[model samples]
Each structure stands twice: as C-alpha cells, then as structure tokens.
Target: MNPVIHFEMPYEDRERMAAFYRSAFGWQTQMLGPEMGNYVLATTTETETGDRGPTQPGAINGGFYGKHPDWPAQHPSVVIGVDDIRAAMEKVSASGGQVLGEPMEIPGVGHYVSFMDPEGNRVSMLQPLPRG
Candidate 1:
C-alpha cells in the first residue's frame, strides 16, 4: 500500500513561519532561494540525510510553500508515495479522483503531482527516484 510520506502547508512569511516552527517544535528549517521558488524545507526529525526521510518510523516531515493568490485550495495537504505515478494517476481517475495536472520533476527528489480525492480533498503523490 502507498504510504503518506510528506505534508505541505502554505505560509505568508517564510522567516516568520520558520521561526515559529523552530521555537515551538524545534523543527529545523532550510530556506531555499528564488532559484527554487523560495520554498522552505521544514525538517521535523533527525534523519540520516535531510529531505531523504525521517529516521524514526511513523514520523514524517513536511515543507512550506509561499502562498499565492492564483493557487487554488491552498490548504494543508498530505503526500503519498507511489510506486508508479502513471498508473496511480489512472487509478485516481478511475476511482472518481481528479489528477490536477502533469507531474513535475522535483530535481533529485522525484516526479510529483497533486490530485483531488473522491471526497474533494487535495492530496499529492510522489514517485521517488531510485538512489544509487
């Protein structure tokens, strides 16, 4: 079964959000510059490699994105890891879900896409690239 691997939430101020998380939860934050769309990576666990995953089981990390007016349904969402993105997209459609758009490459991360489930909840799926 696919697992819920990551979560995402929109933030208006990157630094303020980072500070709040760091102070409240002691979560580490990495601020990416404009080259990467000003995305802030929020690390919630002690992992062997940042962004790879959480070292502890049942613990997941997430990131924060800059909120945009044009972006629809900017609510907190969970990301599921899938083995085959293409097949998963098909399954979503077949099961009364709607794939948002074409999957996009996330550099060393993987191919990622968002979709709306049968309940109209916005969720994402990711197919991580094989590590050598």
Candidate 2:
C-alpha cells in the first residue's frame, strides 16, 4: 500500500516555530534559505542521509512552510508517496479530486503536487527519486 510519507504545516515566524518544536518535542529543525521558499525541515528521527523520512518504523517526519496569503486550504497537510505521479494525478481527478497545479520538482526529493480530496481536504503527493 502507498504510505503517508511526509507532512507540512504553515508557519509565520520561522525561528519561533522552530524553537518551540525543538524545546518542547526535542525535534531537530533545519531552516532552508529563501531560494527554497524559506522552508523549515523538521527532523524527528535520526537519518543516514539527513532526508525528511524517519529511519525507524512507525514514525513519520514533517516540515514547515511560511504562510502564503493567496494559498487556499493552507492548513496542515500530509503527503502520500506514489510510484507514478502523473497516473496518480489522473486517478485523483477521476476519483473526484482536484489537482491544485502542475507538479514541481523538490531538488533531491522528487516531483510533487497538491490536491483536494473528494471531501475537500487538501493533501499532497510525492514521487520520490530512486535511491542509488
């Protein structure tokens, strides 16, 4: 079965949010620069390559994004991993979901796109790059 691999939440003050998570939950945070949309990567578990996913089973890691005024359904969202993103997009559409926009590359990650499910909940899908 496809997995819920990653998650995202909106943040206004990057530093404050990072500090709160770090202090309260002991989660590590890496703040990405402006070119990467000032995204904050939260590492909840140890990693070999420092990617987002947790190294241990039964655990999941997520990230934080700066809030955008124009974005709709800007609430917390979970990202599901898919083998074929294009085909998944078609299936989502066929199943009464709306693909938000064209897929975008996430550098070392993979192609990703957000969508609204039939119940109107916003979620994302990612096609992870093959590991070498």
Candidate 3:
C-alpha cells in the first residue's frame, strides 16, 4: 500500500512560520530560495543516513510553501509516496479526485504533483528518486 510520506502547509511569512514550528515542536527548518518558490523544509524527526527520511518507521517530514492568492486550497496537506506517478494519477482520477497538473521534477528529490480529493482537500504525491 502507498504510504503518506510527507506533508505541506501554506505560509504567509516564512520566517514566522519556521520560528513557530521550531520553537513549539523543535523542528528544524531549512528555507529555500526563490528558485524553489521559497519553500521551507521541516525536519520533525531524526533522519537516517543521507537524510532520506525519519529513522523511525512511519514518521514523516514536511514543508511549508509560500501562500499565494492565486493558489487554491492553501491548506495543510499530506503527500503520499507512489512507485509510478502516472499510474497514481490515473488512480486518483478514477477515484474521483482531480489531478491538478502534470508532475514536475524536484531536482535531486523526485517527480511531484498535487491534487484535490473528491471532498476538495488538497493532497500531493511524490515519486522519489532511487536511492543509491
């Protein structure tokens, strides 16, 4: 079964949000630049070697994206990991969920895409790059 691997939330003030998470939950935050759309990576748990993910099984990490007025459903969402993005998109469509658009490569990460479930909740999927 596909697992929920990551999460995302919209932030109006990147620093403020980062500080809040850092202070309240002790999460480590890494702020990305404009090329990455000012995304903030949040590490909520101890990671394994190479920082792939949490060392503890089932523990997921998440991020924060800059909120924009043009974006729809700017709410917190979870990201599921899939083996094949195209197949997952097909399943989402078949299940009555709407795939927002074609998946985009996330540099050293993987192909990623967002969708809106039948209930109008925004969620995402990631096809991670192969581990060496």
Candidate 3: regions farther than 4 A off: none
Candidate 1 weakest ten by summed lDDT = 46-55
TM-score (all chains, Cα) for each model: 0.94, 0.95, 0.97
Instruction: Estimate, for each residue in 19-66, the C-alpha lDDT of model 1 and write its tens digit.
Output: 999999999999998877898888898876645578899889899999
The whole-model lDDT of each prediction reads 0.91, 0.92, 0.95
Worst 10 residues of 2 by lDDT: 46-55
TM-score of 3: 0.97
> Candidate 1: global Cα-lDDT?
0.91
Model 1, position 69: C-alpha lDDT score: 97
lDDT tens digits, residues 1-132, model 3?
Answer: 999999999998899999999999999999999989899999999998887789999899999999889888999999999999999999999999999989999988999999999999999999999987
Candidate scoring better on lDDT of 1 and 2 = 2
Query: Distance (Å) between predicted and true CA of 8, model 3?
Result: 0.4
For residues 33-68, what per-residue lDDT tens digits would candidate 2 score against the true structure? 998899998888776584545679867788999999
